[model samples]
Target: MTDYSSISTKYRAYNITPDTLAGIVAVVKKFTEGPATTTIYLDDDHEVKDHNLDALLADSFVKAQKIQRIKIESRKTLGPDLVHSISINFESDMLRVVQVTITGDRDRAILARRELDTLLHGAEYWYSFSLAPRSSFLPFFLSFLIPIVLISALSVFLTWLFGGEVTEKSTTGWVLLPLVVFLAGYFGLKDYVFPRLTFDIGRSADRIKIAGYWRNILLTGIVIGIVVKIAIDRLLK
Candidate 1:
């Protein structure tokens, strides 16, 4: 089994009718709490309406039902879906609001969920990850930090291509290399990677693809950069 000790879950809720809203309010009241801020999505008009519990309870059934769907989103937001399909129950009296949640690095998601649960004890809630948890952390570090380092190293090494060394006399270039590298890597990786993936409701396949692409690119760049650097150093000598 995959160890969830390293993975954390995010909690959210839907199905927040005025009835459930009132129940949530009463339960949270015990702890001087309130209901989650609900964001409603309307299918007919394609509009989003945000309301706190108080406002939802005050609204008429027609208006509340206009909610069509609702969700309590976590701060760790995922990209919108490219395609979504839903089955509506016309015979049902209440909107079938779905609970949207996600799982991620254990420390962050667990802390957030624990606090949220403490804040709202009675609300129906669930948790999940937008993507599959990495079996390890190396993929994340590689995707996020290594690119910046690689870009910086690439910039500094490229100076040798012109038989120039980064020295105290070129303090400005050394200082600027990281910034230049950051922008280049940001744009380069974004351009190279994002296009290979698509955004969706959950489990971003694109990110997985990007991880593989990033590993390949990082390894390739290092190998090529080292070879070129060695050649340049020899020629210059």
Candidate 2:
């Protein structure tokens, strides 16, 4: 016996708002290519409704429910060879995080995934993100390195500027360190951790590969901790 069926799965996260439901609906329509069954699990009542995306995602209905999760199975499609299952796990926070699990046939799963991303990123109100890339390390490394270098340089330059003996310590160093930490969190993490980074359609995120994303996150956490410690130490003195 030979088995040819292959399944592929991907995990993704998106920052969604009330305004972006239309984008989701459009993606669903394109995916199914016909009427689809959507199961909207509302906190008020958990019901499975065989409705189209537009009705399922109506603004009034959406506003009413504290959505726990949504399961959308493709009912009809131009490409019937693939089975599509989309699970949107909702998190109750200001970020309105939607962790999506996409399971599809192996060959075209990537294509199916691209459709949703295209819509999410193309629209103004939707955003998606994946694990940071290798290039991420460079900026974070710079974030760690540049602060000390700039501060050390400023320390000596300011002393010379003020007609004092050159020293490798200054108030500017302390100020810059904390500000760097604060600014990175305020700007970088805002755009990184949650998915609200300045984005272009279908182009904002890159998947963390099989090398493993958790390691990337953990390493970044360690770097962040070190950076913060340096800042705090400077602040205390």
Candidate 3:
């Protein structure tokens, strides 16, 4: 078999007419099963050449797949006169695939295309779909515990403010009030509050993560505050 690299190298050396460039890009599109975006970079002096090449790539990619969207971008840079980079981005409910392929071969370009497909199927990529939860014990504890402690402390303060006098008579109620509130908030808000505040963050983490540690703590505080208020009223009566 003729070496594709050798053929590509020869093709590059000679002036590739507009017609020939179109034919080449057409052949490359046959390898990819889906839509793609093709970018052609050429020396500033080669504007016509770049435009022709891009149009060719776009047309061929569209012809290859009805579902695929093809776009062509061209820019003139100092280094290479003619170079092509193709990037394909595709996603499904379970998986996301991104591929970048560059080649000189008219036929061997398919090698890069096939490599990307294989990568999409491999265990590393496929298993990523399972959406495993990541563990960060410290963050998780802080997310829940810190608020409970703070709210409980606030309740203690509020009891003192209410003239409960921090004496032994009032001490148990003061402490118990906050503790009860903290627990109630922690449990009640666990399902409602925390989930709402951390919804975006958790979902972004593939629904396996949580954030807003301080927010969770604050929510607990709100609950504790209400509990302390009720407890103080009952005790006064």
Model 2 shows how many backbone clashes?
Answer: 0
Best by TM-score: 2
lDDT of each: 0.41, 0.45, 0.39
List, residue by residue over 33-127, the lDDT tens digit for candidate 1.
22234454443655443436555434454243333334443222223421111111111111212222324434443554454445433433232
**CA shift at 187, candidate 3, in angstroms?**
2.2
lDDT of 2 by residue, 1-237 (tens): 111232322223443443454455555555446444556565557554545655555546554545555555454433435555544434433334344455554434456566655655544232223222223567545644654575456444434443455344434344445446645653555433333222121211131121136446745865776677577769979
How accurate locally is residue 159 in candidate 1, as Cα lDDT from 0 to 100?
Answer: 65
Task: Please identify which of the two predictions, 1 or 3, would achieve the higher TM-score against the true structure.
Answer: 1
Cα-lDDT of candidate 2: 0.45
Q: Least lDDT summed over 10 consecutive residues: which range in candidate 2?
A: 199-208
Tens-place lDDT per residue, model 3, 49-113, is 23344564344332232221122322222234433344432222111122233434345456655
Candidate that would win on lDDT:
2
Model 1 reaches what TM-score against the true structure? 0.30
Number of clashes recorded per candidate: 7, 0, 2
